[model samples]
Target: MKLAGLKSVEGAHDESAWAAAWVPETDTRPSLLLTGSLDETVRLWRPDDLELERTSTGHCLGVVWVAAHPSGVIAASSSLDSFVRVFDVDTNATIATLEAPPSEVWKLQFNPKGTTLAVAGGGSASVNLWDTSTWQLIATLQIPRPEGPKHSDKSGNKKFVLSLAWSPDGKRLACGSMDGTISIFDVARAKFLHHLEGHFMPVRSLAYSPIEPRLLFSGSDDAHIHMYDVEGKTLAGAMSGHASWVLSVDVAPDGAAVASGSSDRTVRLWDLGMRAAVQTMSSHTDQVWAVAFRPSGGSSRGGRLASVSDDKSISLYDYS
Candidate 1:
């Protein structure tokens, strides 16, 4: 597999673009790109050409993450101020406003079955699960605090959760933390299962292979990406090449490869078979914060990858 630049929008937002996700295609529209930025706005874009579709503004602080519902009609954006706004994709009408404060929200994701929304609770050391239909706070899966002298400090930033990913089967949920621990949970029972350990720095991004539900990948501040067998409780492999922190990672729909964006201001395509970066594209002048592969089965024809950066730019790539 390889990545070729398709289109890039310079100054796509007034500030750093932090997070992105693909909205599935609807009957009247093609697959669209959704991005959140430090500008306190969430913007939608048409694919291939990447034309601006619309912009939704209401966030007081920078938007940290955006997630689209599997149905493609509704989506959610979480800001640094801990507010989560769920809105209509086409109409941009407010669907719901959610917050579990003083549990600040970081990364947000919709469960594969579309029944629940899993949010990474920054500083709260837990994953906040919300029921989709009722839009109510359902459960909080708390990560077990590590035994140490600092354990007494309940608000210690060491366990600040930064990112989250749900297994393809939607039976398991995994969250990454500031102290570099990946906590896995049993979704149905809402029970904390185990921790996947390796990196000593913060793990900023994680992804589970769509084809192999047990295979997990994580990118951390240590500038390395580690693959794990979540069910087996073992490290499968580690890939390194980035000159700076690996900020975000996403697995392709086909599960043939993975793409990552880094603080090195580069986007890399890693061949899963080789377990190495097969290509790197350095186009942005600032740190790349988020990378997402467009989900399959939309009006989208081929594989597409989107990356957002601190330079306030968005780049789209053709992956084949």
Candidate 2:
């Protein structure tokens, strides 16, 4: 698949757009794009043409993260203020307000089953789980502090959790941290199982392959993207070309390509087999924070990509 630039909406939000996700198609609407911005607003966009549909606002500080439910009717976002807002995608009605004291909130995801929401609990070194049915805290999967008396000597952000991903089977959850370590947890037991090692900089984003439950991809501030065998606990491969931090990554639904957004102000498409970037789009004037490939089998006439940037812009591309 190749990307053809479609439309770019300049100043789509007031500040840096930190996260983006494609909401799967529903019967009433085709498929919508959801984005969260440092301006403290969460927005919905009609894809292909890049038209604005709605904006949901209530966040006190920067809206740093956003995630959509598997059913496409609900989405959730988190801010630096430690609040997680789960709301209706079409009506903008608040469905749940989840909070954890002292622990800051970062990236969040609704499980593939659409039954639970997982929030990366910053500083608390844990991932919090909430039941979608009751909106009640169900479990806390804490990452054990690294073994060493000097562990506390490190900076506070070292163990600070930043992003998360749920395996397609819904049995495993992986969470990334500022220390560059990814914690793998067993959901059934709610236990920290092991860690994945590779990136030495903050691990900002990660995605589990739609086709392979064992394959996972990660983007890091180390200016590299890594492919991991999540169950094998080994690095499958590494891809590098970005001049600055790689902020986000998502694999194509077709399973042949991967897309990444970087602080270098570009979006890159990587051919998985070659393990290299084959295409770069530099339409954003500032750091591009999030990039997402639309889920396949949608009403969309063609392959689609949605990206948001620190330049306060949103760009859509036709992937063919």
Candidate 3:
């Protein structure tokens, strides 16, 4: 597989774009792109041509993450101020505003069945699950504080959750944190299962392979991406090349490769089988914050990869 630049939007946002997600195709429209930025707005874009469709604003601080529900009709955008705003993807109408105060929100994902939403609760040291139908708090999967003196040494502070991903079947959940620990949980039971360890710096992103439910990938401030066997709790492999923190990672819809954005101002595509970066795209002049692959199944044919960067730009690429 290979990637060819399809289009690039310079100044896509007024500030750094921190997150990106694909909204699946609906009866009326093809798949679209959703992006959140430090500019405090969430923008929707048309693919291939990378055209700006609409910009939604109401966020109080920098938008950190954006998650699209499975139905393609609804999406949630969370900012640094700890508020999650769920809105209609097409009409841009407000659906619900959620907050778990005393617990800051970072990354978010909607379960495969669209029954629940999982959010990385920073500093609370837990994953907050919300009922999608009622928009109510369902459960908090708390990570147990580490044993010994470090617990009192404010180690929980170091355990601040950063990113999250759901297994393809939606039976399991995994979250990465500030202290470099990856916590896996059973979704049905809402129970903490185990932790995957290796990287020493904050794990900023995580993605589970769509084809291999047990194969999980993570990107970290250490500038390396590690693949893990979530069920076996083993570090399967590590891929490195970026010069700075690896800010985001996403597995291709085909599950043949993984894509990553980094503080190093580049986007790298890694061949999973080879366990190395096979392609690098340095189109952005500043730190690349997020990279995402369009979910397969739409009028949109072929694979498309989107990257947003601190340079206030967004780029779309054709992946084959």
Candidate 4:
């Protein structure tokens, strides 16, 4: 499988494009591409052609993360101000503005079932989960610091939670921290089971196979992508090629491949069975902060991947 560049938008944002995610296709429309940037706006784009649809502005201090709910009617974006804004996807009207003080927010995600939203807590060393329907704080899954937090632990650093992913089954949750540890939690039980240990640098991104609940992929500052058997508690394999930090990762819908964006200013298409990078796309001149595969369902057709970069551009690629 490989990626063919279909469209590239230069200066898609006034500043750096820091994050990207695909809003699943709804009955009324096809899947849409959502991009967040340092310009403090979240813009929606029509897929394939990359036409601008709408720009939602409310965030401040730059939007660092964006996530679309499974239903496609709702989305979320977070800025450096440590606030997560939940809003209507079509109207851009505020649904909820959420914050857990003393605990900053990094990345945000909606579970596959769309019942909950998970936020990576920066300083609290925990994951804040909110009930989707009520938009109320439901639980906090804490990561144990057996050795206690080091004096060097700070609010915005990777020492705290930086990224998170939900298993395909929705029964499990995993979070990555700056100290290079991935914690797997049992969602129903609200318990941390164990840590997936290997990389010593911060794990910036993570994704679980859409087809396999136990298979997990993690990207980190170590510049390598590690594959793991989450249920088996084993390091399944590792792939290395990026010269810089692996900033983001996402599994293809069919589960045959993985896509990653990196500080190397390159996007890679990895063949899962071969455990090798089959294609590398260097269209961005700066760090590629996020890469996301459009979810398959409803009116969705072929495969598409969207990537946003610090170069202030958004690139669309057709996956085949």
Candidate 5:
């Protein structure tokens, strides 16, 4: 798949578009792209043409993260206010609202089975697992504090979790923290399993290869993307090219190429084996916050890539 710039709506929102994901097809509509922005709104875009379908409002602070249920009927968005709003993707109705006191929410993901939703709880230093049907807090997987003297603002770098991912099996949950640590948790036991360490800056986004449950990819403020062996707990590979912070990373469905969005205002396509960027699209004038490869299982023509930027624009690319 390759990118063919189709349409870009400048000033699509009032602020940065922080997150983007594809909502699978339904009976009436093919499939829609969902995006969350710093403007405190979540927008729905029709692919290929990149037409705006709907704009959702309710968030009080910047919307930092979003996730779609596997069934495509529901999706969730989290903001700086530490609250998560789950809603109906097609109807735009509220499904549930989740929150944890004093602990902000950053990133969220629904299990592959759509039975649960995992939220990255910032200050709480844990992943909150909620039952999808009842929307009740099912488990809190907290990352254990390291063996150190004391943790305070001086060490704010350590315990703050920023991003989260769930293994395809839904048995393992991985969370990235402020101090550049990624923790894996055993969902069944609700216990912290281990930590993956390498990046020294905040790990802002994480994704698991659709084919390899043990392989996890992370984008960090350090301006690099690291591939990790989640089960083995080792750094598999590190890919760097972006001149600024790497805001988001996503793997193509075929598992051969990965795409990243960066503060350098470009979207890069990296070849997995060569561990180098093969293509760079500098179409956006501002920092690109999110770049997502359209997931398979729909009427999507060719491979599609969607990117949202600080310039308040969304660009759709055709990945051949």
Candidate 6:
């Protein structure tokens, strides 16, 4: 129900830390923290003391997003240079390097089942799905252009895809665009379903309730966090507090609370039923770019929440 500061790593990266995710536990080791920074590197960290386990290089123009597969063995990251790199978690061995040209890569994710990887395709207004086994591009779920605009119209860029989340059931995919629209797609059919509208600014991050496949939370430059019932295509509620853009949003492992990091230089944890922020951590000096709750269940639930910031630092908190 609350978070207590456990540790903070100053200068965790050479530049701004842009993304964070928890690599699930493996047979040999416990769950690990995965983070990407504007320094063009991704690093793995062991818990509690936050020891650096591995440093991964080769990305350019900064790493924009990072996602760990459910199996805890493989991870995928995309860079501002427009390439998605999939690699082994323990050895940091490159598994695949993917890019769909003329369709810039933004945030990328592995589905709950770890069978498919979805990449937000900027400018293309589509979500590119890859078959995890063969690393083959399977399909592109293109967002339909608005009714009247010509295909060549420059205004089309407004719908640039930036963030995405897969439902717990793995049957649906939801993506957020720059135009403040959240689009849902049916995975089996590879077809766009509908749009969830509420925010009018860039939706930077999204997270789904692990317990409810149809519930979604989105963060936007509009400086608000919106909860939506995607299945009903309705705005369930909105929480307001951050003074600047909300850069990232995450749902707690138990689904009773939500966490957000923002340009306001703070991380806020919200009480779900009350629909309000219960606590705000302001240890960060600059914009907080990413916030992630460690993925776990049963005995290790609500284990940890990590927020990385433009200040080049990472702060970890114990949530219970």
Off by over 4 Å in 6: 146-154, 298-302
Model 1 is weakest, by summed lDDT over 10 consecutive residues, at: 146-155
Q: How many pairs collide in each candidate, listed in order?
A: 0, 0, 0, 1, 6, 1
Cα lDDT of model 6 by residue, 1-320, tens digit: 99999999999999999999999888888888999998999999987779999999868779999999999999999998888999999888999999766448889999999999999999888888999999999998998754333234566788899899999999999999888888999999988888888888999999999978779999999999999999999999999999999999999988999999999999999999999999999999999999999977523445799999999999999999
Compared to the true structure, candidate 6 yields what TM-score? 0.96
Please write out the lDDT profile of model 2 over residues 70-113, one tens digit for every residue: 89999999987779999999999999999876557888998989
> What ranges in model 5 sit over 4 Å off?
147-157
Which residue pairs in model 2 clash with each other?
none
The 10 consecutive residues of candidate 4 with the worst lDDT sum are 146-155
The residue ranges of model 2 lying beyond 4 angstroms of the native Cα positions read 147-156
**Candidate 6 — worst ten consecutive residues by lDDT sum?**
145-154
What TM-score do all the candidates reach, one by one?
0.97, 0.96, 0.97, 0.96, 0.95, 0.96
Deviation in angstroms for 233 in model 5? Answer: 1.6
Model 3 is weakest, by summed lDDT over 10 consecutive residues, at 146-155
Clashing pairs in 3: none
**Per-residue lDDT for 131 in model 3?**
95
Model 4 earns a TM-score of 0.96
Tens digit of lDDT per residue, candidate 4, span 1-320? 88999999999999999999999888888889999998999999999899999999988679989999988999999888779999999999999999766448889899989999999988778899999999999899998642435424554454588899999878999999988889999999999898888878989999999898799999999999999999899999999999999999999999999999999999999999999999999999999999999987776678999999999999999988
Question: For residues 239-269, could you state the per-residue lDDT of candidate 3 as single tens digits?
Answer: 9999999999999999999999999999999
Backbone clashes (count) for model 3:
0
User: Which of the numbered candidates is closest to the native, going by highest lDDT?
Assistant: 1
